[model samples]
Target: MDIATKQPGVLKPKVGSRSQNIMASRVVLTVLMFALGILMILPFLWMISASLKLQIDVFEFPIRWIPENPQWQNYERVWAGRYPFYRFYVNSIIVTVGATSLVLLTASLGGYAFGKLDFPFKETLFLSYLAMMMIPPQVLLIPRFIMFNWMGWLDTLTVLIIPNAVSAFGTFLLRGFYEQIPKDLSEAAIIDGAGHVRIWSRIIMPLTRPAMLALMIISAMWRWNDYLQPLVFLRRVTNYTIPLGLDFFVQENTAQMNLIMAAAVTATIPLLLLFLITQKYFIRGIVLTGIKG
Candidate 1:
């Protein structure tokens, strides 16, 4: 006779109780996650609501989830204001795109060499790069500023693009992804008369796409939202990026909270869109990197 059939009463109660416990635990976890998700989204909802309100209504006594009268014109004012916000948009796009592209190129090649190819002092070099990450970015500001000033790059878009073109973090993240790839694939490519370039391009790169996508999103976000670097490097008002331009606007129009919110919303939309578009790859990249590393 089967065990269940031989001990029906005992097995049934034990199995039922275990299942009930599991179901209860899952229910509690689900409720907690749902509440946390809502909490995280609340600030974004408030920002959207405030962007449509009148200046005087923004910080009114009690919180207003929705404005009584929406001021849609705030967006137009932000774009057409004396600050030339369009210029900031163009500058930001140029810098963000240029820096992100350069970072990907350098990081991929460096990661491949460090992770796959053999070379002298490779580990030592990579360890040094990792050590650099521990140094606070603030500590590098003076040296970078002086170097850029010497190169006559200050106040130019090149200043923004060149200084941050390569990232240690990008290299480290991509290296982890590359190391996770099986070496046998590279060996097979080599046997087929493929050089390192061909093996990297044809075999390794295609496999590590999720990691690259994550790096792209991360690099783009940092470049786009950078404030201090732009504030220090860019002098001309017309050359300002979105963050610096928004700060200027807030300073000039301190009383116009509605306009400020509109500007903030405009600055945030691109990042939101980027995350939405690559969210799947981004999450996969994070999980894979964490596990592999």
Candidate 2:
């Protein structure tokens, strides 16, 4: 009986020790993650600090997190200067919004057809479509430029918007989500006299909000940041998007780091706002996108 009582006492210490080990490990992990988060945000913090500082203070030995005398005029020079930076904002917004909308519409329709509909040579067509993605975008740049020139679209925002409107990746993303949706839902809709258009818009589209948001975010980011295509196509300074506009600012104000940083901060606000608003749905969409039927 004394031995049996000793066995229970020994087991209690082992269990307590295991719990303590787990708690210690968790505390260590939490500290590491917190450090990493701070590290990742440091660049943005530096940018903001530099934006508010004079050019001489930007590369100071011991970085100041905040400037003693904030130069709010850096932002004023960027916005009110002769460069027409506000026009760049308008052009970027137009192209990004237009491309993102088109991507969503086309990707949803194509995904619905591929994932839900019965048709001849469907797999072969999809494979062919996927094959297009393998071809280097640079290889087609010359041809696209020639085609745009022929169509009188060069130096226009249309050149920027049209190429990005259809996205192979977006279709692939939404198709996976669409496939996981039960066929019974579409069948029931059909029985209720709903056609393909109605089914796609009313029945199927509502269930795939997460995937749609993911695609929208992806397409918008791509269009917003595109430089190469705009550089190759756009000639007029008036037609420049944010990336091109920033490039122009950098060229003209090479010594004015403060002004450059201020311009960058202004350019980044829209994307930051977009993420802050839709991050919840974006995360949900990304998680649900991978689960297969």
Candidate 3:
């Protein structure tokens, strides 16, 4: 009648029969992943092929998988081509850096304040930010354009850079990250006579590098590839960013599909490089933020 006297017949096997099922599942997943990888790589392969091809080879009856002669000059041509792709690149870099810096500064401050501080109407203020997320960017486009025009910011760099600088999505992401910090840590800092600024500078920001990188990637990607905003804001061709500049190549090289693909491929490399550099932090930040939020 004792618990220790339990019979072996009542005991289940130590190893379950699910090993076969699990192995089968893994095999299926591997196949699925291989297919997905090929799918994702096709466009990039085509782009590179197009970038290297002669204008005629791009539209050859049997699509050329590899260029017989790689026009290494195509890259140089793209740099000096149509709308000054080099200038567009510089402009995109400038705007991307500025926007990313602004997002990091404001979102880190805003997220820290919301997550840690206990001021009046704090929840309400953050709720307002969350509400803004529901409002689609397209809905505010016309009004924002009008306001920027009134500010005499139309066609200016600020017209492109400032509006996207402070992202609600960034703030939302960082606030969740900030909340994950233990209150005891902040209290200890406070007990040491540390002000909010000291605690944020010394503690919060360092602990949230992943979150900051996420915001940087988000802000940079949006700013770099921002087509509609630049298209509408940049009236003059010389001031265009890569996305807006790409349009010129598309139009001018319409008959030369290879050249257009070359331009498209060129426009894409910076973003790919950016992602490659920060891929670890970017992916980790997203997964952690989603779990925490």
TM-score of each: 0.84, 0.88, 0.85
Query: Per lDDT, what order, best first?
Result: 2, 1, 3
Model 2, residue 103: C-alpha shift (Å): 1.2
Q: lDDT tens string, model 2, 83-154?
A: 768999999999999999999999999999999998999999899888886888899899999999999999
| Per-residue C-alpha lDDT of model 1 across residues 107-175, encoded as one tens digit per residue | 999999998989999989999999988998889889989999998999999998987998988899888
Estimate the lDDT of model 3.
0.80
Clash pairs (backbone) in predicted model 1: none
Those runs of model 1 whose alpha carbons end farther than 4 Å from true positions after fitting are 1-36, 286-293
Candidate closest to the true structure, highest TM-score: 2
Regions of model 2 farther than 4 Å from truth: 1-14, 286-293
Error of 3 at 185 (Å): 1.8
lDDT of every model, 2 decimals: 0.85, 0.86, 0.80
Residue 70, model 3: lDDT of 92
For model 3, the stretches where C-alpha displacement exceeds 4 angstroms are 1-32, 289-293
Where does candidate 3 clash, by residue pair? none
Model 3 vs. true fold: TM: 0.85
Clashing pairs in 2: none
